[model samples]
Target: MKPDLPTDLTWPHTSINNNAHRVGFWILAHLTHDPAYMEKVREEIDAAYLTQGPSAEPDMGLLLCDCPQLDAIWHETMWLYNTASAIRKATRACAVGGKRVSVGDQVMATFRQFHLNRELFGGDAGAFRPARFLDDKSLARRKGYAPFGGGHTYCPGRLFAQREIYLFVAETLRRFYLELVGGAEGTMMPGVDRNTPSAAAMGPERDVEVVLSVQKL
Candidate 1:
C-alpha cells in the first residue's frame, strides 16, 4: 500500500497555480507595452513552429529549449516581479551578516534585494530589459536570480511552472494579437502592487484593459 503524504506536500501544488497566473499576466502586460519586443518574440515563436511544418503542433522540446527570446522574457519577468521569500529556522545557533542567531530562530531572505541590486544586475536593474538575460546567460545562474527561492527548499515544481507559462504565452501570442485599449496612455506599464503580503509573484497595482484580435494565418 502507498503511504499518504503530508498535507504540506501540497504547498508546491498550490504555490505553482497561484504564481504562474500572476507571472503570465505581467509577462503579457510587458509584451503589450513593448510592441517591438512583442513582435520579435512572436516572430521567434512563428519560426520555431515553422521549422516543425505548417500543420504541426508546438513541440515541447522547441518550446522549452529553442526559444531564447521567450526564455529571456521569462527570466526578466521573474527578476522584475518575483516577491517570494525564503524562510528557514535555525537548528542550532549561528551567525548571519554579522548578526548572532539563537537556536530555532527563523531567518527570511527576500529575493528582491538581490534581484534589484545594481551591483548584480547593473545600472538599469530597475528597468524591465529581457535582453540582459539573453546577452548574458550567466545572469540566470547567478545567486541574484533566485525566483525559485534557494537551497534544498528550492521550488520542486519550477520546471513544470515554467513550461506552463511558456506554453500559455507562446500559444496565446501565436493565435491572437493583443494590444492595450487606449492610445498613448494605455501603453504605459502598470505599477507593481508591492504592498501585498509576501507572495510567490507580485501583481499589478491597477488593471489595464487590452483588446485581443485573432491572428490571421
Candidate 2:
C-alpha cells in the first residue's frame, strides 16, 4: 500500500519561494525599466501610504486591499511572467477541444499558454499592460491561466504567497528608493532548454544582470 502523504511535499515550499522571488523581481525589473509604469506604481504606493511616515509601517491589510492598482500590478505580472505548469491526471474520460482524454491521461496546463491567448487577452497579448487586469478582474478568470493552478489541484499557499509578496514589495518601497543601474530593459525572451526540475515554471532560462541602488530613507 502507498503512504498517505503528498508525493511532493517540498514542492510547495520551493514553488512558493521561487514564485515570490519571481514576482518581486519582475516588479522591480518592470518598474525601473519603464518610466511610465514606474511612476504609476510609485504613485499608487505613495497615495496608499500618504498618511504614514517613512519610519512607520503601513498596515498590511490596507496595503493588500486598498491599493487596487498594486494588486493589478501583481496580477498582470503573474499573468505575463508566470512559469508554473500544472500536470493533472484525468479522473474520468472526457472530450476537450475536439480531443478525447482517457482516465489517468496526463494533462499539462501551462500559465503562459492561457495568459497569452489572444481571444481572452486581445491582440497585444505580449505587451506589458496592467490596465488589462485592472480594467476587469474577470480577465484573470479566463480558462487555463493558472498562476497558482486552479480547482482541486490549486496551490494551497496561494493566498499566503500573495500576501508575502505584497508585504515584501510594500515594505521595500517604503524603506528604500530602488532604481536600476545601466537601464536593463524588461522584455520576455524565449526560454531555452534546461535540465532543472522547475524548468517548466522558469522564465527565459537566463538572467539579466542589473545593478540596483537601494537608498534607505
Estimate, for each residue in 1-217, the C-alpha lDDT of model 1 and write its tens digit. Answer: 9999786756866686668988999889989888999998888777767544334567778788888888999999988888878899999998999999999899998998889999988999989989999899899999778999989988888898998898889888988889889866676888888677647788788877899998765
Predictions in order: lDDT: 0.85, 0.70
* Highest TM-score model number: 1
Q: Give the TM-score of candidate 1.
A: 0.90
Q: How does model 2 score by TM-score?
A: 0.77
Model 2: clashing residue pairs? 83-201
What's the lDDT for residue 208 in model 1? 74
Give the top-scoring candidate (lDDT): 1
Error of 1 at 65 (Å): 1.4
